[model samples]
Each structure stands twice: as C-alpha cells, then as structure tokens.
Target: MSGENGNEEESRGLKSLRQLIRILSVKSGIDEAMADDLFDFLLTVDPEKGISDEEVEQIKGYKQADVRKVFRIFYDLRIASYRRGKHPDTGATRYYWYLDSRDADLALLRRKLQVLEKLKMRLKYEKENEFYVCPKDGARYTFDYAYEYQFTCPKCGTMLVPDDNSKYVKVLEDRISRLEEEIKKDERRVFGR
Candidate 1:
C-alpha cells in the first residue's frame, strides 16, 4: 500500500510536469506538433547529458531550421537548456539540449504566483466595474467606454446592454482558490517550506 501510494504521488508529479510544459509551450505560441516532438525527445533521453544536434536532426521530415526553432521555443520557456561540447569521437564541436527539470519546477512556481496575482486583480476589477455587452456581437466593455459609445455597439450598431458577470466572478474565485492550494502544496514539496 505504501509503495502504491508512492507511485500515485509520482504519477501526479509527472502529470503536473506535463501540464506545465503544455501550458508554457502553448503560451509561447509554439506549434503543438513541434512541441510534442521536443517533449518526446526529452522524455526518451538522459536529461543530464541531453541530446546532440545530430540526434535532434533525426526528427523525420523537419527542416534543420525548424528543429532549431523548436529548440529555441523550449529555451525561451526556460524549461530546456542548451549547451555546446566537444564530440568524444571526432573532437568536433557539438551542441546539445535537454529539459531542465529543477529550473522548470521553479519557473512553474513563479508562473503560479503570477497567475494568482493576476486573477486576484481581475476578480477585483470584475467586482468593481460595471460591464456592458453588445447584443449583436457579444463584445464587452467597461462602463466608461460603453457610455462614450452612447450605449450603442460601434461595430454593428446594436444596443449595448448591462451584463451581469456574476458567473465569471464565481469562476475566477474558484480558480484563484484552487491555484492557491496547488501552489501551497507545490511550495511545500519544491521549497521544503
């Protein structure tokens, strides 16, 4: 039973890692296919040594430039690392890349904090602001902006109506609560706090 619980925790950690990678990759606007490729490659390799340029080039049908671009996307996310070294056989210069797991945990922690702060600010705004929505286009605007448009939709000329965003407030509140809990747990694990 204890071993099974350990496995479950390990699985949860892995799922969180994958989720973090997916979020970071999508937020970077990297193509989903290319991001999957990079993730798969890293999963198959020993992270300490990473994979060489030649190995990365083995990704079928991808242009060298495209592969490099994928690498750059990973590098930009800070979850991946790039380094150069001498080939043991040929003594030629070679480049390698790999996932930075420890750094990734820290980055995810920072992202959770940023998201928590942003959500709190947005929730406050949602609570404080009077919102108007265009009946035709579903476009939303603040009270001041809507009043400037004379309570009319500029795009479609439909009347702007008061929108009750109570559901959105609930959603934001729930998200904020869940994220705060997750961050607290992750902090305890990652920072030993």
Candidate 2:
C-alpha cells in the first residue's frame, strides 16, 4: 500500500541520517551514543519551533555541555541550524536547534566528494610508488627510502624485499569506482540531474 511505501521511505531517510551522524561523530571525536541521542531528539522537534539545548538536556538526561558539543558539531557539518530566541519564562537568550533536510543532503554530498578526492589521490600514490618491506620486521618503506637505507631494515638489519602492492591497488580502484557510482546516484537523487 501507499502507507507502507511512505513508511519505507521514512525509515530510509532515518537510516541515512543516522549514518551521517555516525560519520560526523567519528570525524569530530564525539561519542556516537550521545550523537545518536541528540539526532533522535532533533527528529522530534518541530522545524518551525525548534527545541533549545537546555530542553534537550532536561528531556534527554544528557549533560548540557555534551549536548552543546554535539550541537556544535552538527552546526559545523551543516546538518543542523539554530535560531536565537529569548526563553519565554526567563527572558534570557537561548538557541533553538533544528535539522534542515536540504542542508543535510548538501552536507552528505560534500562529504562524499571529499572522500572521493582523497581516494583518488591515494590510488594515484599507490599506482606511482614502488614499495619495499623488511622481511623480518614487516616494516614498509618507499623504494627511494629503502634504496637510501641500502635496502635494509634499520631495526632488525634484515634485507628489504619488494612489496607486491597489486592487491592494494586493486582494492583502492574498486573502492573509488564504487564511491563514484554512489556519488553519481546521490547527485541524481539530491539534485535531479
């Protein structure tokens, strides 16, 4: 039924949002549990009347400082926004936070682009460089560095051998290809292009 389809779509959106929050948490060095809690709370907020961080702390039982930290990360990632307002009871300034769906999509796209660029750079380096590894210590070095050191392991005094990086190169290429396909699909979905 149409209702089932609607529910499916809603769940998919939530799943994507959760994944984005997890990524942001790792990148910002925040606790994933706290970020998930904050994200779930934000989902219940009315966009027109956003909820303040203090309210979130009171309702969610999270430390005010921790809530603020997560909110700051969300803001920095462009997944959330806040508006300044005065508390109705205290007549003091407060910030009410809410998620902007469009901004979240844009942020996701930007992140994907960044990852794609980094992967491409890594693939290029892997393809261009010849690597050497110490047979005993398992330490890896570039061809130039190994040659400079007389193709020996400094720590163990073991002769260095050529490292076969074809597998690694193939893995990078596959990842880059998959990520490129995903980005193209996301662009079509988000931008209708």
Candidate 3:
C-alpha cells in the first residue's frame, strides 16, 4: 500500500511538471517540442547543480546558436539562471544554466501576470474606441475611418450605424476580472504568503 501511494504521488508530480512546461512553452513563445527537450535536459541535473551550455548542446543535439536561442527563452521567462565560467587552460567562456522548480513556479506566475496585463490593455482599447457597423453586411469600422466613406458599407452600400459594443465591453471586463482572480491565486501559491 505504501509503495502504491508513493508511485501515485510521483506520477502526480510528474504530470504537474509536464503541465508547467507546456505553460512555460506558451508564455515564452518557444515551441512546445523545444520546451519539452529543455525540460528533459534539466531533469537530468540535480537541483543543487547547474549544467553547462556546451553540455546541453551536446545532449540535445543542438548547435551553439540554437542552444543560445533556447537559453534566451528560458532566461527571459526567468525559468532558468546562468553564470559565465572560464576554461582554465583555453580562457574560453561558457554559460552554466540552472533551473530550480521553485523558480519556474514563480516565473510562471510572472508570465501569467504579463499576459493578463496585455489583455487588460486590449480591453481598455476596446472600451475607448468607437465602432460603426453596416447593418446590411455587418461589417465594422472605426469612427474616423468610417466617416471617410460617409458612414456607408463598402461592400453592400448600406449606411453604417453606431455599433453598441456594451456587451463586448462587458465580456472583456469579465475576462479581465477572471484573469485578475487567477493571478491572485497563482501569486498566493507561488509566494506562499
């Protein structure tokens, strides 16, 4: 029974890690396959240790430039940290990467907040912009742009009318609210305060 419980807990942890990698992949704008490869590579290192860029390139079969791209993505998202090291004999520099799971969790929280901030900006734009729609074709246009056409549908030649975007604004507001709540929860979980 104890063995079964241990296995179950390990499986859950593994699943959660996979999910987090996927989220990190999306937020960092890196391909999921690349993220998975990086995650696997990171898994081979002990949490107390860091891996060199050359070692990672060899293990992942990626060239130095490709490895740099991956490293930048991880670094930008704060999923990993690196420090420069020098070869004693050759005087060459190398980057050592460290991916602590705790850091990854905090980075994910920050990424979510950034995404939510962009969404909020878009929502604000929607709330501020005036929209006009052609009743015949249901085509929409911005206020000044529509005036150039004399407020008529370009496709159907119908006069355009003011579009009531209250529902759209409300929907955006609701989405922003939900994201803010999720961010709060994520912050609480990651920060534990």
Candidate 4:
C-alpha cells in the first residue's frame, strides 16, 4: 500500500538522520549518551511549530543546560534550527528548535567535501615526502626531520630506518578515489542532476 511505502521511507529517513547525528556528535567530541538522548527528543518536535528547550527539559527530564549544548552543536552543524518567539503567558523571549530537513542533505554533502579535501591533502603529502621510522618506538618522521635528528629516534635513541610508504600512498589514493565517487553520487542525488 502507498501508506506502507510512505512509512518505510519515513523510517529510512529517520535512520539516516540518526546516523548523521551520531557521526556529527563523534566528530564534534560530544558524549554519545547525550547525543542519543538529544536525537530521540528531537524526533518528537513538530517541524512547523518547533519546541522550546524548556519544553524539551520538562518532557525529557534533561538538564536545560545540557539540552542547550546539544542543540547548539546541532545548530552549528546546520542539522537543527531555532526561531525566536515570545512566551504567551510570561511574554519572555524563547528559542523554539526544530530539525532543518531542507539543509540536512546539504550539510552532509558539505561534510563529505571537507573530508575529501583533507584526504587529498594527505595523499599529496604522502606522495611527496620521504619518511623514516623508529623500529623500537614505531615513531614516524619526514626525511627532513630525520636528517636533523641524525636518523635517530628522539624518544628511544634507536636508529631510524627508511620507511616504505608506497603501500600507504596507494591506500590514501584509493580512499581519495572512493570518496570522490561518493561525493559525485551524493551531489547528483541532492541536486537531482
């Protein structure tokens, strides 16, 4: 039935959104428990009439400060948004928060692009540099640094040896290629191209 299909699609979207929140939380160094709680609470908010942080605290039994911190992180990531409004009873200004569905894909695409750029930069560095390693301490250094140190490990005083980084370079190149392909797919999906 069409209703069943719609429900399935909605569930899939929810799952994706949850995964995105988890990834963003880890990337931002937020506690996993807080992120999980925040994600669950956000799901209950009405998109059109967003919920206030105080309401979230009252309903979910979370500390207002902690809820605000998670909301602020989501706002920074463009996953959540808020609007200023006056409380009807108290006439006090309040921020009502809701998920920004329109910007979710854009935010994900932007994050992928950022990661792709970093991978490309690292690939370039790997290809251009000669590396040395300390066998005892497993410390790695660039040729210039190794030369300055007389090819000796600073921590353990072990002699440094040339590191064969061809395999590592290949791995980075592969990752870069895969990420580029994923970005292309996401762009097409997001832009309807």
Candidate 5:
C-alpha cells in the first residue's frame, strides 16, 4: 500500500511539473518544439525541481536576465504564474507557472472590447462638445457657452481665442476615434458586415 501510494504521488508530481514547464514555455513565446526542448532541458537540470537563472539561460538560449525577461512579459500580461516562492538554498525568487485554464485569448478580446466601448462613449461626448480659450487670461470654455457669453474672458474681459490648439484634448479625441474605428473593424471581422 505504501509503495502504491508513493508511486501515485510521484506520478502526480511529474504530471504537474510537466504542466508547469509547458506554461512557462508558452508564456516565454517560444515555438512548440523549442519550448518543449527548453522545458525538458530545464527539468533535467533543475537541482531542486525549480527553475533557476543559469538553467533557464542554458535551456532558452538566453542570458539569465533575458530568460527572466521572457517570463516577465507574461507577468505583465497577467496571464501566467501560479504562485511566488523563494528558492530554498539560494533564496532567489521563484514563480510557479500555470496555464490559465480559462480561455485567455477570449479574455483578451473581451478586455479590448470593454476598452473600445469606453473610448466610444468618450468620443461621442467629445464630438458633441467644442472648446474655446481666452487669449488674454488663458481661460477655457465650451463653444456654445463661450458664444452665449460672447467669447469674452470672464476674468480679463479680452476676446477669447479659438482653442484649436487644445493639443492634449485633441490627442485624447484622436485616440478615442482610433479606438472606435478599431472596434468597428473588429465588429466587421466578427460579423462580416
């Protein structure tokens, strides 16, 4: 019974270890064959069954820093890492990797859609608004309000300048427009219309 239990434990451990390796490899953006080769190499070389800097470099054909960088990309994307732990002997940081069981590609798509929707709403509001500025006092106003008040600086009483150079606001408007266009493109791709 003890032997059977031990064997089962070992088998489960091996399977989980393999899964971790695959996640790390995919997150690193390596091709399937290369990632597999790298995974095998790392597993074979890890003294504590935890990947280390030196082993990562040798397996991934990168410097220690570079190999770690590939993993960091996944970190930035929030799509990898099961847990953080410290190395027992060296006290170096280690991250256990996990392939997100959820559909990561679809998640990314949904996130993009949400962003696009927000941008579209903002753009809709901006398109309805026009901006103006006072040349004398540098006061800003919306078009209709400014016109109603005769484009005069409330503080300095100077004629307000047409604020065509609201560069930052214009940039935001441009970004929103671009995002809206992208959303339309994505919709077309999805619905073929």
Candidate 6:
C-alpha cells in the first residue's frame, strides 16, 4: 500500500513536471523538446527539488558521479550555486546544486532563505560568544570563563589578551549578501519584477 502511494506521488510529480515544461516552453518561446531538456536539466542540477541523482543519471545516460561532475562544471562556470559538504560520520563529501531556471526557481529561493537563517544564527552565536588567549604563549581559548583570572594564563601565566578579532563575522555577512543577490537575480528572471 505504501509503495503504491509512493508511486502515485511520483506519477503526480511527473505530471506536474510535464505541465511546468509546457508552461516554460510557452513563456520562453522554446520548443517542447527543448523545454523538456531545460526542465530535466534543472532537476538534475538540484536533486532535492524532487529529482534524485540516480534518476538524473538514468535520464542523462551517465553515472551518478558523472552528473556530479557536470554539476561541478556548471558551478565552476558560475551557472549555479553548487553546495558541497562533508558528512561528519562518514567523512564523505556530497554535492548538491541549484539551477535558477523556471522549473525549480522556488528551490533556490528556499535555499537562500535557509542560508540567511543560518547566517543569522551564526551571527548571534558570534556576537554572544567570547574568546580568550594567553599573552605569553598564543594559546587559544573558546569557552566561557577561559580567562577568569586577571592578567593570567592557565597554561603559561603572563598577561592575557582578548583575541576577539571576530573576522568570521565579516565573512558570514559577505556570504549572506552574495546569496541575497543570487536570490534577487532568480526572482527577477522568474517574475520580471
């Protein structure tokens, strides 16, 4: 029963995908076949938008890693925002990409919004977080009460200096701005507003 339901959902998703392809073809004045290619391209670029790597590879007549390589190529060309992250448990890096094309534009927006929220959380953590360092030796401290004593280091007592450069804050802010610009571009392309 569950398998049947899953198949039903998959069929519905494919139907909607075809409808989207037709609409995009009408909007962009492209042929149905070309629009279908574009739609499939978007799905392959961003699997989380209801496409899987295996499915994309099947459609493209390539291996899954080959699809990932294509995604990397597009990323290097600045065509899409490809994300690569390492799994903490397995230490294997996986890549996910986004194409701001019509079929999956909302996925890009949602990803940008998620990044913004994460940046906000990181900024809060950075603002509230404190760091301590030993003056004699350049030992670093990253917990509360790291330098509770005055002008002293736990390892080598000389004179402690607060290492609160907080350079990461600037980096995060820059990333947020870049994502915002990308989201704006996608919005403009989709809505022309």
Name the top lDDT candidate.
Answer: 2
**lDDT, candidate 3, 55-143, per-residue tens:** 77777776766566666766765667777787557789876777655666554555455556667777777787999999887899989
Weakest ten-residue segment in model 3 by summed lDDT: 1-10
In candidate 2 the C-alpha lDDT for residue 116 amounts to 72
Q: Candidate 1: list runs displaced more than 4 Å.
A: 1-101
Q: Taking the tens digit of each residue's C-alpha lDDT, what string does model 2 give over 24-86?
A: 888878899889878767755766799888899889988888899898877876778999999
lDDT of 4 by residue, 7-121 (tens): 4444565567667777877777777678777866675566679889899888888878878878988787677899999898999999999877556555456556666667777
Residue pairs with backbone overlap in model 2: none
How much lDDT does each candidate structure score?
0.74, 0.80, 0.71, 0.78, 0.56, 0.59
lDDT (10s digit) by residue, model 6, range 65-174: 64554444434434445456554567776544566344355544544555566676777777777767786788866556674665467777766667774687888888
Q: Sort all candidates by lDDT, best to worst.
A: 2, 4, 1, 3, 6, 5
How many collisions per candidate? 0, 0, 0, 0, 0, 0
lDDT, model 6, position 162: 78
Write down the lDDT that model 5 would get.
0.56
lDDT (tens digit, per residue) of candidate 5 on 69-131: 554544454533445678778988776544232233233334455555565555555666787
lDDT of 1 at 129: 99
User: Of the candidates numbered 5 and 6, which has the greater lDDT value?
Assistant: 6
What is the TM-score of each predicted model, taking all chains together? 0.52, 0.54, 0.48, 0.53, 0.36, 0.41
Candidate 1 lDDT over residue span 33-124, tens digit each: 66676665665555568777666777555666656776776676576786888888999988788777565555456656666777888898
Point out where model 2 deviates above 4 Å. Answer: 1-100
Global lDDT for candidate 2? 0.80
The better-scoring model by lDDT among 1 and 3 is 1
